[model samples]
Target chain A: MTAALSTGPITAEEWGIVSLSLRVSAVSVLGAAPLGFGVAWLLARGRFAGLVVLDALVHLPLVLPPVVVGWLLLLGFGAQGPAGRLLADWGVTLMFRWTGAALASAVMAFPLMVRAMRLSIEAVDHKLEAAARTLGASRARVFATITLPLAMPGVLAGLVLGFARSLGEFGATITFVSNIPGETQTLPLAIYAALQTPDGEQAASRLALIAVGLSLAALVTSEALSRRMGANVHGL
Target chain B: MGFDIDVFLQRGGGQIVARFSSGAALTALSGPSGSGKTSLLDMVAGLVRPDAGRIAVDGKVLFDSAAGVDLPPHKRHCGYVFQDYRLFPHRHVEANLLYGWQLAAPRDRWISLSEVCELLGIGHLLRRMPGALSGGEKQRVAIGRALLSGARFLLMDEPLSSLDALRRAEIMVLIERIRDDLGLPILYVSHDRNEVTRLAGQIVHLGAAHGVAFATDMSQGEQGKACA
Candidate 1:
C-alpha cells in the first residue's frame, strides 16, 4: 500500500482539486439540507393534493441518469436560459461556474438527503405534536420543539450522505457547468482529465485515493453521529 | 371561570354530542372510552372543531359556524394530555416541560416548572430523556409538561392506562393533588370507573341515549356498570 501510494504523490495541483471538491460539496450540502428537510417533512407528514407526485419528483434525481439531470440543469440555468438570463441581469452567473457545479452536485445528492429525512420525520410520533398543540404551542413552535428534534438523527445522516454524494458527483457537475480548471474542475474531473493525458496516470491515481479516503471518512462520521442520535432519541 | 362549551361532534361511527356549560375555573368531563369522551375534551380544547355547532370558552366564541369564528388550537389556552402520554422523546424532561411555557402569553402564565415537577413527582427525571423513564415516569413527565405550559384548563385522556395497577394507584393520588391544588378545570377521559369515582367531582357520561348528566355519586360502581 505504501509503495502504491508512493507511486503517485499528491502534487500541489492535485491538492487544489481535493480542496475544491471538499469546498463545493460542503456548499452544496449546506444549501440542500433545509430544503431537503422541508421537502422530506412534506413528503412524510404532509397531507395534501399532489403529495405523491411531489415525492416522486424529488426522487427523480436519484434514479435518472446523472447526465440527464445535468442536461436539464443546462437547459434551465445556462447563460441563455430564462433563469440564467434573469440571474445574469443581476450580475450572477451560474453556467460553467463553480456555483453551477455546486448546484449540480446538490441536485444529485438531494434525493439521498430527502429520503433519510422523510423516513425520520415519518417515524416521529404525531401524537407528540398533538400533545404540544394541546399545551398551547403554535404549529411552528411544535415543529421546532418536537418534530425537528425527533427527526435530528435522520437530518444529520442526510446531511453527511449528501455531502459525500456531492463530493463524488461527476457526470451532473461536468454536464451542467463543464470542467473548467480551478473553478468547476472538482477532484473526479481533475482525475479524469489527468488520466486522458499521457504520463498523467500517477497524478490521477493519487487524486483517486484522496477521494476514496474522504468518502470513507464521511460515511464513518455519519454512522457515528446517527447512532448516537438514535440512541438518545430511543432512550426517550 | 372563563370558558363554557356546549356542542355535539361525531366520533368513531357514533356521534359524541355534548352540550354543557362549565364557567371555567374547573370543568370536569368524565366518561368511558369510545363514549365520545376524548372527542368532547378535544372540542373544548379547540383541537376538534365540531362538524356544525357553537363552542365558547371564557365567554369567548371559540367556534361558531354561523359567526365564522373558529380559533385554532394554539390560540386556545387549554392543556391536553393524551392517553398514551405523548412526551417529546428527543427532549429531556425539563425541555419538554418548558415547551408550552415558552408559548404562553406572559399574563396568562399559571404553573411553573418547579411546581409542576414537584406536583407530578418528576423533579428527578428532568435531565433524563423520555426513553429512560418507566411508564409511570413518562406519565408524570407528560402531566408536568402539560401543566407547565400555562394553559388555563387541563384535558387528560386516559392518562394512567399504560401504568401497572400499583403505578396507576400512585399516580391517581398525584392527579388528585394536582386537581385540588391547581383548582384548574380538567376534562378527564377514562374507561376506568374507579378513576372517575376517585377523581371527578361532576361527571358527564357519554354513549348514554339520554344526554349529559351530573354523576355526583361515586359509590355506585355497580350502577355505573349496569348503566353501560
Candidate 2:
C-alpha cells in the first residue's frame, strides 16, 4: 500500500495511458453509435428477407473471443489486406495505429450497444409512428420525432456500456495494434505491461483501480443524464 | 367535387363482400364490433391494400389497379385521429403539431398551427408532454396534430372512444364545431348509433360477422337494401 502511494497518483506514462484510453473510447463510441442505431432499428422494426440471419450476424461479435476479433481485423486491415492497401494509398493507415486500436475496441463493444438500442426501439409504440404518418410526417421525420426521443434511455445505456467496454479493451486492442507505448497503449494495456515488469506491480495496481473508477463514473454519468432527459420528456 | 372510391373488398375469409362507389365528402363508417368498419376505412386510408380496386380523391388517383398505381401511406394527404389518441409521448405538444406541417407540400399548407391550437383548446399545453396531460387533453392534442397536417381528407377512427363520458361530451361539441367552421371533409368511424345520428352526413353501415355493408344518407334517412 505504501509502495502504491510511492508510485504517484498520475505519472506522465500513466496519464498517457488514461488519456489514450479515453480518446479511443470516445472515438469508438461516436463512430459506432449511428451504425448501432440503424442495426437496432432494423432488428426491432424492419421485416424483410434474411432478418433473422442479419440479427444473428450482428450478435456474433458479442459471443466471439476478443482475440479472434483482433485476428480478423489484422487480416482485413493489415498492410497487405485489400482494404488496407486502399486505405494506405489514401494516406489513412489503420494497422497497428491508435485508430486500429479504437476500431478493435468498437468491434468488441458493438454488440452490447446494438442490443440495448434494439430493445428500446422495440419498446416504442408503433401506434405513435402510424399517427405521425397520418399527420403528414414522412418516415424519417417520424423516426426523428417519435422513435428517437422515446428510445433515448436505452441509447444512453448503450453508450455508457460501450465506452466502458472500450476503455478496458485489452486482448483485441493488443492483438490488433500491438500495444505500442505512447501510441496504442490504452489503460488496460499499460496495466498489463506494468504487471509483467519486475518492480512495476505498484503501478499496475493503481492503474487497475483507476479503470474501476472510470467504469463506475461512466455508469453514474449515463444514469444521471438519462434520468434528466426522461424527467424532461415526462414533464416532471 | 370531393372524391370517388369504387371498390369491392372481400371480408372475413372471403365469406362477405362490401362494395362502395360513394363520392360523399363527409362519410361516416359506423357499426358494432367485428363489423369490418375499420377495414373499410383502412382501404380508403391506403393502409390495407385492396386486391382489385380503384381509389380516387378529388380527381387524384390513389390506388388504381387498372392503371397500376398504388400510393403508399406517406404520399397520401390524409389526416388521422387514432382511437387511442396516439400522441407522441416523447414530444411536446408544439412539436407534435409541427411534425405534419413540416411534411406538407409548400403549396398544400392550408391550415395554420394557431388555428388548429385554437380549435382544439390546447394552446396552454403547448410545452407539455403527452404523459403530463389528461385523457381528454391527449385526444384534443391528437386531433389538433392531425388537422395541422394539411390533409385533404381527414379520418377519425373512433377518436372519442377512449375518453370518459364528460370528456366525450365536450369533444362531441368540438367535433361538430370543427365540421361546421373548418369546412374540412372528414371520414369519421364510430360504433355508436347515437354518435352516427349526431355527426354523420353520409352513413355507411356494416354488418356483424359474415355479412354485407352498404351506404345510406343518415340525414335523409334513406335505407338501402342490405345485400348479403
Candidate 3:
C-alpha cells in the first residue's frame, strides 16, 4: 500500500477502461440520435393534446436523480422485467453488460440532445417548407432537404453534447451495470475506482485528466462544426 | 391557363371573401395593403384552407368546400413565388431549382432544368447559393424553381415588392416573356398600379373591406383604360 511515484505509460488495464469508455459513449450517442431527432421534431412542430406531457417526459432525465433513472431502467429492462423478457425472446439482453452501460449513458444524455435539436428544428422557417410544398415537393422531401439541412448545426451540437455527457456518466452506469472492469467502468467510474484504492491518486488523476481532455475535445469539435454549419445555412 | 377562385377565409379579427374567375394568361390581383390578395393566392396554392367555395385552374379543381376536396399544397401544382422568395438558402441555385424538378413525375415535367434556367436567365448562377444572389437573381431562381417543378400555373405573391425599381422593371419584362412565351397562366398579386396595369391581362381589384371587383375584358389594348 506504499504510494510510489510511478510516471509511466498508461497501463493495459487503464487502456481497457479508456477504450471501454469510448465505445460505450460512442454507442450511446449513435443509438440516441435518431430517436432524439424524431422526438425533437415532434416537440417542435406537433400540435396535440399531451404535448406538454411528452416534453416533460423527454426532459425528466435532466431533473431526476441519476440513481432513480437507473433504477427505473432496471425495472423496465432488467432480466426479469416485461421489456427485458420481450427482448430476451429476441436474444437481446441488457443486464450487467456493455450495452446496458450504453443504455444508461444514452438515457442520461437524451435530454440535452433533444433540447438542442428541438430548438434548431423550431427555428426553421415554416414558410420555406410551404414554398417547397408549392413546388410539388412532398412533406417528406421538404423535411429531408430543407428542414434537416437547416437544423443540422443543432443536431451536430446535440450529438457532441450527448457524446460528452455519455462519456462522463457515472451514477446511472454504476447503478445499472455495476461498473464491471472492461465493460461498465467508463472514464468517470474508472476514476472513482482508482481513487478508492489505497495508493491510486496518480492513476485517478491521470484518468481525470483524460476525461477533461475528451470533454474539451468534444466541445471544441462541436463549436467548429456549429460554426461551419451556421455559415452554410445562414450564409453569414 | 385560367383560374376560377372563390374563397372565404376567417382570419384573426377580419373575414376575407374573394370571388373571381379569369381565362387570361396573366390575371392580376391588385389591392391596397391589408387587402387579402396574398390570402386568395394562398388559398389557390392550397396553403390556406378556404372556409367555403372552390379553386380551379384551367378546369382542374384544386379545392372545393362543397365537394370536400382540398388538395394539399404539393398536389396543387401551383408554383408560388413568395414575396421574400423562399428559396432554400442552404442549397445552391441549381440544387434549389432541381429540388422540385426531381420530385416531379417524368410526364408531369413540362419544362426542363436547362429551359427554366434559360428562361429565367439564371443559368450563370447555377453554382451560387441563394444568399449570394441579388434580389432579382433570387427572384429569377425562385421562378425557375417553380417552373421546373412542372407547375400547371403560377402564383406570384408580390413578386416585385421586394425589388428595387430597376430590378422590378427587369423582372416585369421577364414575367411578360414567361406569360407570353411559356403561356403558363399566372395569378399576379400586387398593390402597384403601374405594375398591375402594365402586366395584367385581366385585373381583379381587392378592397380593404374584403370586396373583390373584377375588371374583365381588359386586354392589352384596354389595360390603360382600365387603369384610368
- TM-score, per-candidate, Cα-based: 0.86, 0.87, 0.92
Q: Which stretches of candidate 2 lie over 4 Å from their true place?
A: A1-8, A224-236, B1-3, B8-17, B21-25, B105-107, B208-228
Residue by residue across A97-187, what tens digits does model 1's lDDT show?
8989999999999999998888878877777777788778788877887788778887898899999999999999999999899999998
lDDT of 3: 0.85
Q: Which whole-number lDDT from 0 to 100 does residue A135 have in model 1?
A: 78
**Candidate 3 regions off by >4 Å?**
A1-7, A88-91, B210-228
For candidate 2, lDDT tens digit of each residue in A1-236?
12456456676667778898999999998899999889998899898999999988888778888898888888888988888998988999887789999999898889888987887778777767777766666788777877787788878888888898899898888998997888999998988888888888888888888999999998887778567556644441
The DockQ of predicted model 3 stands at 0.65
- Give the per-residue lDDT of model 3 (tens digit) for A152-188: 9989999999999999998888888897777778889
Q: Candidate 1's C-alpha lDDT?
A: 0.77
Candidate 2 local lDDT, B37-69, one digit each (tens): 677667767777877767776678888988999
Q: Which candidate is the best by DockQ?
A: 3
Candidate 3, residue B154: how far the Cα is off, in Å: 1.2
Give the per-residue lDDT of model 3 (tens digit) for B1-228: 388777777777777777767777788887777777788888899888989988899899999999999999999888899898888888889999998888888998998888887777888999998989998999999899888888889999899988999999899999999999887889999888888888888888777652433223344533222321
Residue A36 of model 2 has an lDDT of 89
Candidate lDDT scores, in order, read 0.77, 0.78, 0.85
